[model samples]
Target: MVKYVEGSFNEDYIQTLGVNFMDKKVQIKSTNITFLIWDLGGEKEFINMLPLVSNDAVAILFMFDLTRKSTLNSIKDWYRQVRGFNKSAIPFLVGTKYDEFVELDFQDQEEITQQALRFGKAMKLPVIFCSTSHSINVQKIFKVILAKAFGVKLVLDEIVNVGEPILVYK
Candidate 1:
């Protein structure tokens, strides 16, 4: 996945090039298209550290565990807050775990999925289900984001196709 600094420039910011500088403070590049990814720490204590989101943010990928109904419940409020901060109707929604769904309690899974679908309609965002551990549709997530970012369509040719052009750095 891509990584970038969350806040404004500081003394810690460094300049470098290519894969050799993977650990640089800020790294920017393009495979098929340029990605200005911002990595925000998922810590409750860092609530005050809201990074400045650009007007051109084509998508907002909100991820959560499908087994956790509590987290899914909070998505609506989070969507509300994000909408308040960003008036743009960017494509944004929850991404649930794919493989873990079968292992989770049936009630929790159903409840979260139902809530997600409801909020998705209310917020007009597309909910993308994924599993990073099994590599299940993880790349598709980026493809959706990039397609939305560029305003295009992603076509699938076969049952397990990575679309027409698979541009993966790793």
Candidate 2:
């Protein structure tokens, strides 16, 4: 999120081993909004904290590693748990590490992309593919979230293709 707010990428960001709290003020049109972000590593020990973050959330972003199919598979369980807490929260399905994902073979990329689209369609979640290291689609993700949360129409074209950074907002 530092990359989103500060416009500088950090190579030394460690994964959240536990809950981390953050907030950022952003302008959507003429409105000033402060977003409270709570991060919890998807560890068994921290599953109990899910409700704290999920409850009353404007949106819930479920992210997976593009290079790891196992990470994608685990999202279903996380989705289910989060839904039990706040069903009205707009859900976003994101595939991270697209910079490394593009280095994979063509067939693997196609498979992951198709699987992510299928999951996004099934869950009615906006699917976004991004790379934090390269700052791809990072700001767009928040824009989409704001547009959805505020019931504003987003006019960005969806990128639908294999082996490309997807920003499916439909």
Candidate 3:
């Protein structure tokens, strides 16, 4: 998961087998605010540690596989657990594996997208469809987190003029 956020695409990685959690201190490029990111595995054994890790979270991101409906259904349970720990934490619903999802039929794609939208609406959280393999919306997700955490307006410079130098002020 950290590799995904950091823009490393390795599809051959194996799934996590146990209740493992890792933390990394990352600096948001847009805001320059250092954030401690706790990547928790979604295993039953990790349920007990939710409160301990999420107590100081500014934002919580619940990601599910777009090609799997069951993963989407599990978001409710995850959201509930996170909210129990920190009601004030901003929540984000992320649909991953978008590269695979696009290969599905139009009807299937629309159905999954609609379902995800409904869940996001019901949870009152923003939804993002991303493909780490294709580097889609990966950075945007963190930018949204930074904006929400610090109440800052984010204007992403998607394209810069050749001669114009970009500057980031502290």
Give RMSD to native, each candidate: 9.7, 1.0, 7.3
Worst 10 residues of 3 by lDDT: 161-170
lDDT of 2 at 100: 98
What is the alpha-carbon lDDT of model 1 when measured against the actual structure? 0.50
Q: How far off is residue 144 in model 1, in Å?
A: 1.2
Ranking by TM-score: 2, 3, 1
Give the runs in model 2 whose Cα sits over 4 Å from its true position. Answer: none
Count the clashes in each prediction.
Answer: 0, 0, 0
Model 1 has how many clashing residue pairs? 0
lDDT of 1 by residue, 44-95 (tens): 4433433344234556665566667676666665566556656674655545
Instruction: Record all residue pairs in model 2 with backbone atoms less than 3 Å apart, i.e. clashing.
Output: none
Across residues 68-169, which tens digit of lDDT does each residue of candidate 2 receive? 988888999999999999999999999999999999999999999999999999999999999989989998999999999998898888998988899999
Least accurate stretch of 10 residues (summed lDDT) in model 2? 1-10
Task: Tell me the tens digit of each residue's lDDT in model 3 across 1-170.
Answer: 55544547667866655434554456555434555667666666878778866898888888788889889888899898888889998888888877888788778777777777778778888777877787777777777777777777877643212111111111
TM-score of each: 0.65, 0.96, 0.80
Cα lDDT for residue 67, candidate 3: 85
